[model samples]
Target: MSLYFFARSLVYVIFKPLYRIKITGLEHFPKEGAVLLCSNHIDNFDPPVVGITSPRKVHFMAKAEAFKLPILGKLLPDLGAFPVRRGMSDREALRVGLKILKEGNVLGLFPEGTRSRNGELGQGLSGAGFFALRSDALIVPCAIIGPYKAFRSLKVVYGKPVNIDELRARKASADETTELIMKEIQNLLEKNR
Candidate 1:
């Protein structure tokens, strides 16, 4: 936990001036309770940017490959991130994420599952929706706008909680819920950009 905060603060101090990072809609972030903070992934820095800006400690699902790195591998879990294998069904990763939400902690997800190659919003994968349905966590859609260049302004915008209570009450599928979550994220990107 201390390492997480220390890394977070370090990112803020280093990236704030270099990127001129600006975040809005932070008020939409809930102060407590189980929350799924879903966002559009754009670059390698997106996770840290969201983590630093969020009021809560975000446990992110990092790529399994990253865990093989000499230093980052050892540090990711300490920073509350677990590994998820891409291009395959990684049930263990899903269980870990759901447990985080069930414990009333924030779990960060990139609905796109990977960074967008075009800097445009891509379709959301079902991870965020799956967690939301299983844990009833609030889905707060966030948009990250950046090419991530030095001295260039970068922005993170948070949208209001997506209203999925009706869908959940009706026992909707995860894919359908994901569509709604992605729609909200796209709206944020369009509005802010």
Candidate 2:
């Protein structure tokens, strides 16, 4: 197996049981071509949880600070993670994300931009929508529930892919697209709750 797959397997083996992890709606993910996985961020564990559970290899936009660490800096790129500067536009990060999508890979994004400290779904940022529009990739709304507590059941629900062409035809603004994504995520969370 490749290093990325090996690492993901190790993570899944170790954490899945501890968290009682469950994932649903895999049929909604595209079998080929570019796709984006937009999820709500509740904690740092969300990324690995989503990545390991996904049927496809998922490239994530990690913070630039994490890439600065000596060991992780070298390991992250191999594991399909690229760095992005938080709280800034960071055009390079956007470029990397688009490039991954254009190459027909899955890109994992947390539209909220940052973790919600209060366990509440926050407003989404426009980056996810922007990348989807730019790359013409399908956006799959994902909801990750119950990762805040160790030894508790954690659930991940993937909603149906949002139609980028329909949204584009409507002349949807970035904010509008973001809101739509967030609403889908919220709906999934509510259903699971």
Candidate 3:
């Protein structure tokens, strides 16, 4: 945990200034315990953008390809990121996510599954919905706006917690829950615009 703080702090110190990032709703982050941070995908920098701006160190999911480079493959794990194969079931990725929640750490996820090359908000996959339902972790719906714009002040608006119990009680189907979560993320992003 100390190492996670060290690495994240070091990067935050360097990047926050370099990027001139601006963020809001950081007060919404729980001061202690685990949280699932679900955010929109915009650029390749989205993960680090949220990681650095976040009040807590975020253990974000990174695509397997980022770790294909030998040195990074070894280093990313230490930085609290694990890889997920793009097209596979990725049980390992899911396990890590659940374990992180179980261990009481912030698990950041881009609900869109991948970066949006066109800078448009994309549909969120079921990964976030499933993880939230399984772990009962507090899901913080987040929006990252303007990070894709170079030299612009990036805004991140975090919405109130998503209640999984309501979903279960409502007996929402898999697709329904995913679409609901995506819509919440989309609405937050739209508000930031």
The candidate scoring highest on TM-score is 1
lDDT of 3: 0.81
Encode model 2's per-residue lDDT on 3-28: one tens digit a residue: 89999999999888889898899999
All models, RMSD in angstroms = 0.9, 1.1, 1.9
Off by over 4 Å in 2: none
User: What's the lDDT for residue 67 in model 2?
Assistant: 91
Error of 1 at 63 (Å): 0.8
Per-residue error (Å), model 3, residue 89:
0.9
Clashing pairs in 3: none
Every model's TM-score: 0.97, 0.96, 0.90
- Pairwise TM-score winner, candidates 1 and 3: 1
Ranking by TM-score: 1, 2, 3
Q: Evaluate residue 171 in candidate 2 and report its C-alpha lDDT on the 0 to 100 scale.
A: 74
User: What are the per-residue Cα lDDT tens digits for candidate 1 across 121-157?
Assistant: 8887877778889987898999999979999999999
- List lDDT for all candidates, in order: 0.91, 0.90, 0.81
Give the per-residue lDDT of model 3 (tens digit) for 24-86: 787778877879899888877777778777778789888888898988888888878988888
